[model samples]
Target: MYVAVKGGERAIENAHAWLAEERRGDRAVPELSLAQIREQMTLAVNRVMAEGSLYDPDLAALAIKQARGDLIEAIFLIRAYRTTLPRFGATAPVDTGGMACDRRISATFKDLPGGQVLGPTFDYTHRLLDFALAAEGEPPLAPAGGDGDMAPKPHVMGFLDREGLIEDAPHDDSPPPDLTREPLELPAARALRLQALTRADEGFTLGMAYSTQRGYGRNHAFVAELRIGTVPVEVEIPELGFAVEIGEVVLTECETVNQFTGSKTEPPQFTRGYGLVFGQTERKAISMALVDRALRWEELGEDDSGAPAQDAEFVLPHGDNVQATGFLEHIKLPHYVDFQAELELVRRLRAEASAAQSDTRQEAAE
Candidate 1:
């Protein structure tokens, strides 16, 4: 239990003032503009948007600036701010199949339709820090690529679907349960699980996904496809009675095809795990896909050998960094009353033991 200390108002105000001062360090240095953060710190902004469940880059950048670049703190700030905003009707499900892909690849296929577009990626770059970046100078422009076909890229999984080699993921038109609006319930549906995993702590999800790769609830996953691009977001207008494109959002999507041997009830078709997240967060998307697959052990007719990723209760509750940080940090608050009670109990127990020993000694002397 934490009691409010009435006398600390002035001290708290002073501390807050000092914190504001600390947040704006070295007055001679020019302040970082929101535009700079939006452009340069794109990945961080993307992470905040994904985890905070908000898509405004400007707001995410502001949160980052206010939090002094502490990502979890920024996410916390963004989440708190999100609670104040008015909610509009939900947007229709984004059509990723029509994505204007910037980067698209498949580990399962050597060469596919629409071919490979490398785009701007750091995959092949040397890890060494360039001192040139420290000295500000405009870099040379990138060479233009060939004017390729403008047709929408077909999903790699579609080929396997035609051959009846992969399990069919029938489209569901029903409204999905909103985790934000309602409390998370156990035995969560796949849609809810995907929602949680998309915004889950990337490191924790990655670790859980890695554990599966190491043979704990192992499902031999092949990255059937990974794509990064912008897709049009459409929402049905009440007046118009038809969906219209509102805007575009960058998203990274992953589809993992896991080996599923034929069961008595089902066929030997390849099972699929899917992940989709805001912006170009491929690692999180991939990890989410792996963990998503692991959690489907019961549905896939595989035995649950007790893997952390497979436990929905364990994964979903702890995946949120904001909630995790809040719970973990709350202990640092004033807990003197609770501690005093614990101390008193320990003292009483020790005194009783000491008295018992003394009585035993007196009995011996008699």
Candidate 2:
């Protein structure tokens, strides 16, 4: 017997209420303030901002708290909120060259014009947990003469270009294609696809990069530069007919030097892998570069090894962990219809085989 039950409106209301309750937990526990999450759980805020493509720490912190620390869900929240935001206008690309760099390092040259600054990193820290933090003690005071805010922006590539060591990169005010709006097509331009790649799921991107390193389609690479810091964002005002500074955002940028094989027509040119994102995420930027280089094998005249990283179809399709994980988990739902069909086929095949064997024995005896 089949009976239909439907409570669409009631069900949705109940779900929302339940989600609210889960987010708040029991009233006895102190409610987590948005500022607390923004300041204290900064790494979570970084992930949410990185994946969400939003730079507001407070909003990201709120999303993290509401999502109960589920970073992806928080990202989804931020993304949803971002959609509702009215676009006042497009911003002029920040002058990375003018950026008052807080942290910058160049791997290509040991000693560059602007001396390397290792601003803040956990690289040298011991792995021991700080029990003092657990007990809640005041953190060390900031050094005197410090406003943590960085100044303008500057690109490390400026020094190289002055000497004409590398090809000059062109800048344009032309609007770039939006992947979110249009259906993705094959042979995607580097700009369009790269934007999508940056906001892609971290784990999926990591796996694709790992495959290249594991010899799937190896591209020898060296990190030429990796930088993390705040850069002022500016927008062009049509009415004002000039650009105005709006805000600053933390960003991570990576440029990888990849060994390339030149074709008969073209001379050997040093190839590049580039990644830029909104947050101090060296790992994501590094992984993004590796994957970016692998995807450029055809353009670079390198033979394709048919690796997932090299195949735009495979990488772009399966690169989103949210989509992949959802389709994967959805299989746990009721599959009895398909199972029943398979069961019938198996039984029919077995009966036919037995009859065929019986006929063969009878014929032999006769």
Candidate 3:
């Protein structure tokens, strides 16, 4: 009896050791602390939390460092960790209407009930790189406002309702379906499918958005409103029998208005583009809105135009980096067995052809 090459287990163990050593490069560089990553590289932490669907900034930061700044890997780490966590309870959805907003603005209305506040945005900054950051100079602080009224959040939809410009946005109190718990099916409900897509990779989401812009299912969109801020998160403790504020989380919310192409029975109404994430990510929110609009082509009676965004099968299947990368990279594993089979078959076929050609030539000569 013949045996195949052994030491597969040993090889795997050594490779893991090498990887661990590589991950902790430059022992003198002072290891990155979770707090530093959480506070300084907050954007990276935010992305990890948003995509991983876990809001712990410190955890996300640690994942990022462990992943060597690979954001997608950090997200994967968070997702894996999230599965082992104990389920306590869920918080009621924060009334975005009651949000103690740090930043709020609307492009649709010149002035609304709640006045626009351009809180923290890089929008107005010049494109030139700052040389001061190289040396890490302390910058002067902007004048702080006193008695900043903690005003209740106001809705952009409310303003449209007052003007009779948009269809009344529905507020259903029923619990939405969980995308993570169930397998995805086509002709999906907006709530279920959108939740799945929100945690989707930024590059993938961006590609879908780009496809929509390139005439796949172009929907004219306006950023009706966008806001980013912190909100109190309350949880109901069963033993205490009372809801209590457990924590606060920062979130980015985006609402977009799109041209409402009406059907035979339905009247012309402005469609909505919605995106909500765990941090102040304007680009992600805006991109999400555009993609959301493109995905609504069927409901809007817009022609498919064979765009990537309009094709649910294509978009949904390829939207996740974790799944896509795993499946794609899995091809590298021990395919030598398959390769050997193909190689033998090709050689056998060639030998058979050569023999047949020689026999035919002899017969012709004779």
Candidate 4:
């Protein structure tokens, strides 16, 4: 005698109330402020902003706090919030060439024009947790030099381009297909794929990229250059009749040089894989580049190794953590009716088989 439960709305409300209480644990302790999270938890805020495809640090920080530090949930909140906002005119693509680079390194060349400004990075730092950071004290600050301006660095890939060694990525005026507005169709263009990658879940993209390095779809990639810096964003004003800089966003850009030995149709040339992410997310940026290269199997005249990273159909849909989490967690919801139907069918089938077996035995005895 089972009865269907009601009051789902009240249950959800009560659960949320309890959750809020738990999130703000220990009432004696001071509650964490959004500003503190934004400043101290900069990396987490950056992640939310990167995956959410929105640039507001304050909003991302608030979302992180409300999500109880669950970065995926925070990204989801930001995405949901972003959908409600009205879209104005599109901004012109920011030029990475004139970026005010804080950290820039080149793996291909020994020295470059910019002289490899390692502004702020954990690359050389020992991973040991510093106990000193736990206690607030005035730490010795590193001396800052350079006239507050880094010389405009020429792209390393540009040198290769000068020699006509790399494949040409010609500029085109054709508008890219919008993934949000249109339903996802198979065989997405490079532009659409890039859009998907920039906002794709970092963990998923990292795993896919790792799979490639492990011989799934090895591209023999070399990091041509990796840069982290701030770039100005400008939007055109039809009324004012001029473009103005709205703000600047910190970005991490990665470019990988992949060699293609030779193809039947095309001659041997260096191919490039590019990644540009909305924060100082180097790992995601690098991973994106590798995955991007692997996905270009068809266009580059290379045989598909049947790798998950190379499969656009497999990668694009699952790259979104929000959709993945929703689909994965939906199993927890009530499915009693469906399960009861299945259970009854199974029981009936088992009973019929037992009856048939009993009849067969009786007939044999007779």
In terms of TM-score, the best-performing candidate is 1
Query: What are the clash counts of all predictions, listed in order?
Result: 0, 11, 0, 0
Q: Which ten residues in a row have the lowest lDDT in candidate 4?
A: 1-10
Instruction: Tell me the TM-score of each prediction against the true structure.
Output: 0.95, 0.84, 0.89, 0.94
What do the candidate models score in CA lDDT, each in turn?
Answer: 0.89, 0.76, 0.79, 0.88
Cα lDDT of model 3 by residue, 236-274, tens digit:
778999878877888888898887757786678787778
Error of 2 at 330 (Å): 2.9
Deviation in angstroms for 82 in model 4? 0.4
Q: What is the C-alpha RMSD of each candidate to the true structure, in Å?
A: 2.4, 3.4, 3.0, 2.3
Model 1 lDDT at residue 30: 89
Ranking by TM-score: 1, 4, 3, 2
Q: Candidate 3 — which residues are off by over 4 angstroms?
A: 1-6, 146-149, 170-174, 236-243, 353-366
Model 3, residue 138: what's the lDDT?
Answer: 80
Report the Cα lDDT for candidate 1: 0.89
- Alpha carbon deviation, residue 68, candidate 3 (Å): 0.3
Clashes of 1: 0
